[model samples]
Target: MPAPYQPAGVSVGDVPGVAQTAPRPPLREDLNGLRGVAIALVVVFHVWMGRVSGGVDVFLVLTGFFFTASLIRTAQSGGSLNPFTRIGRVLRRLGPPLVLVLVGVAVATALLLPRTRWVDIANQVVSGVFFYANWELAWTSQDYLAADPSVSPLQHLWSVAVQFQFYLVAIVVVFGLAGVLRRSRGVHRASPPPHVYLVLFAGASLVSFVYAADGTSRLQSWNYYDTGARLWEILLGGAVAALFAARHPRPTHERRSSEFRTGRTALAVLGLAAVVACGFLLDGVNEFPGPWALFPVLATIALIAAGPDTSVGHLLRSRFGLWLGSIAFPLYLWHWPLLIFTLAYSGKPSADLATGAAIIAASVVLAMATVRLVEKPLQAPGGSIPRIAITATAAVLAAALVCGSAGWNFYIQRSVSDLQASDELDPFTYPGARELTDGATAPDADVVPALFSAPEDLPVTSVEGCIADFETRDAISCEYGDLSASRTIALAGSSHAEHWVTALDMLGRDRGFRVVTFLKMGCPLTLGTMPMLGESEYPDCLDWTQTVMSEVEQLGPDYVFTTSTRPREGGQGDYTPDFYVNVWNELTSYGIPILAMRDTPWLVKDGVVYRAIDCLADGGSAMSCGMPRGAALDPINPTLASSFRLPTVRPLDLTSALCDGPICPAVVGNVLVYRDEHHLTATYVRTLTSELGREIAASTGWW
Candidate 1:
């Protein structure tokens, strides 16, 4: 990404009108070839396979290799150590393509995405332009519930951000060392030997490796997007670069014997095979940046070492390889947005082979066009962007993106806040679920959570440390609703159960019962092993469930209000898992009566999961965006077939209040039923207060 390896002005023995610059290392054809292959893998796998290829790691290594070598050469020459000149050159090389892509993403987002996603994409743009995309992604991706069709199209810039940050740090460190040497050695020898940098980078790599290994073991989801966890891969490349700089390599390989050439070729072939197989052989998303990442890292190093002697050498120097290398940086920037837009346009979860191929073809065409229109002219010697102009343009683009994104982000956040505050100003105007349970009538009115605010219409536990996130083992609890009342009712389980708090709060306050919550995101209140969160084993969830059960036991609430069952995954009808039954049985043994509520129907159509807010934005009616009852629940309750028949386990189902006839609508009585997919919105849950109160009273005889 560092200026796409700009051709040096006036190489040795070439007659040129340009002034000669400091000597640089000969272009490694093998490295260029490897870059081409890596980019192809990145695109093909992402579009067609739905799997991660370690191509980004390959780029990180190459960035470290090329940048470190260049830094050392500059330092050794006692060159002007001003960092701005160098950074400006890099901007001139990288700025145009980056600005064009950001503009493209902005246009696509405005045209295709729902209002619910506008704030999210704008925040992403602001983060992306300022070169902190990795950190932004880590923060936004923390919630399991938030991962949905709303994935940011600008997400691929995380690698560019990491590399840019490294450039800044690497420049300071290398130049600082050079300055110290100049003072000590009287400016004649301004830099240490290459071995000194080799050792320093090696030490940094080891430290980064330890951090990465520990982080991956602890929480791969967060670590995957962490720059600290990914630094070693790039630093290791710097170590290799320094080692090679110390032992200068020949530009030509003909001086070596035929036997040596054959051996080198064999090693290069083996290394290339490893790079090609790395993604398929290992689960990169779950296991990478850990020790397993060594596979692709070492393979890239091998290609760099092998030089240009084999068929790999010829292929790399070929016209196709050069073309691929020329467009690699822009191609990486272009492919991801194209893929996401394709999915949105088709309204499908993923692209089929034909569709994926078409996307790839489109990406290549766009990449070639970008290289011709945006990259080449600016990077050419006599182009408009002399160093200062490039730097200024980059600053302007970054400011414009930040300003535009902030405008949209502020507008959406304020709008959501206002909607939340006024959602209950007049209950009669938005009667919500009361229209079903109490025959309450009201004039037609707008939904409680307006389309733009729906994504923020979450229950109280979604924030403020009220519930444990997916990563923790701590059983965080909060007291809500009639805290001073003698009788206590515990709300326990995942967000589904946590969402009932709004209604339970009203019931508890009016009926004189305290409501205590035992909640965790995505963790159901069950004795069985919780489902794996993403790809890694969820041992944290396992430990968390036990901690929550113990807390519930100690509280000894009059009745434990919790979700009773889930809609069976990948099949028809709902059923209670044995783990759920075991938890119910154990609570009964503790003399705690159980008020088990059936879960709501998921908003799915055919095989694709759809968000109701997205449907509403696309002009679908409330009932049209809803799910059919038979698709999620049986005609008779599925809980009856389970252990809920036990006297201590009283099943509570209010599907009647949530549904009308056979359909479960996204909005009920002018209130949005769900904030996301299945979790009931706090506003809608509040509307169900009267109906839920009756159920709790009958179950506990508290009334």
Candidate 2:
């Protein structure tokens, strides 16, 4: 559907003639049709193709163009430029449908989603109501625990938030100019001159453009939803509006000259081509809201400048296009959640073409129902400030009630779990290492402790703030095991390596060796650049790695422990990349014995990472939540092959303890094996202390 700020029933043909220097241009049917096309691209790309359609960029431009133009016209015509009236009109138009969707999603989540996901859904619902969902996603993007494939139903609201923010900014700019004109000693006008507005728009656009370019390069995932980074596109629309306002007044009875029509037609054709081509050619996720975004922004401007007189405009203004535009906003809202909920229930990474078509059909029906029943009635001509305010307040309160209930339930569950946990359980009943090595059957799944079922049930390292996050550049070292031990074993690498620290710490404390951790989130001790979220190079990780290695060399630890291999695509077994070999060689040069542990099996099915806890919460059995042993690991550890040629680099594989003969269970010895997809839970890792100690002693003779 059209942008949240797009005025209902107000087309180019309906705008009243302004008594300014230039006659105001009528709203074009073609622009509305363009909005229809943009939303179509977005839905199709998000649902069937799993790509961004660049349609949101087009919508941003249109929102800026339409809203700014209307405001400028109002100011020039000596009409009231009251922010409250304009903002209220926008709120009345957008709020009802958005609230409807939010409430619908809340009900769907309760019925379809597992209880474990309720907290997140509730948080997103609250954010969506307040128009800060983008910032919420931005903060969550940095959290490693929160990173999952289960897309939030409210994720698409980020664009709506950006548009809402822009509306506020537009109101301020327009009214601020009007107030300035009134205060001036000599200049007495309803609005500032067109040039003044143009200068301001240009300056703001330039600043925002630079920030977007730089921010996208550095922290794209966070910047992607940032309103500040998105202002340039809106300002470009404002600039277009200013230029339209500055046009020379045309005679009321005169038609456009032939030359003007010819130029407009040429522009319309090129503009249409550019808009269509952008969806196909550009990679929206990787290169957008930056300098590369200029292509779509410019094309949209050309189309706006072209007006609705040409053949291309005629096509855009067709009945089909107008209908699509009419339902565009609600369609955009309904489609994503429908797609995501369908995927979750179907237990598929993505929907097939037929399934996708059914989803789109369902979305269209819902959108039409919402537009007819909710959006149209509230946005009718009699909408007043008090009415709109009361409705908005009711919507917010309803959303708050849903979110509050979810949060309260989450707190209650966590409290009950905490109280139930006890240190008095029998060691044999909870036998971790003994059951695995002794071939004893594990306790019943129902009898197993509910550890690792929630985010609060994290490993000691995470709970104690030992493991660093993405933004952390400085090395955070923590000591574990026997403090007075003469021999020191250094653990270094990413979170994969950090997961093994619990076992190592227990082993060291028992056998009298000091354990020092040098861990960075997502950063392994490899020479090559690591790929961060969105496939961008992590400069902080690379720089941090260099510093870490330098410190490790100076410390001259007797043994350095880290993960050595990663899983290959298509379940082809783990392999050590060249970077691992380079790091091994560097460590060996310092005469530091390298204990290269094999990485854990990531729980993945059909290329999507699945959390064991989520599967369990959804009533899946241990075997059902687990992958085949062969699918996750090679028969022989890949690190073993690399270690064969290097005397100091010894490979350690505990797959035998973590997995059975053919199958890898989610839980071993009544303990949940993984905290999320790959990281081993501290409870499970502690159970491996005995086995781990035996292996390290055999390899290093430290004990």
- Name the best candidate (by lDDT): 1
Residue pairs that clash (backbone atoms under 3 angstroms), model 1: none
Clashing pairs in 2: 1-328, 1-329, 2-329, 12-26, 12-27
Q: Candidate 1, residues 35-136: lDDT per residue as tens digits? A: 878888888878877677888888889888888887777777667667787776665566667877888898898898876777778887877776788888
Candidate 1 least-lDDT 10 residues: 7-16
State the local distance difference test value for candidate 1. 0.78
lDDT of each: 0.78, 0.77
Model 1, residue 629: what's the lDDT?
84
**Candidate 2 segments whose C-alpha is farther than 4 A from its true place:** 1-24, 74-84, 142-149, 180-190, 247-259, 381-397, 400-426, 440-442, 445-452, 529-534
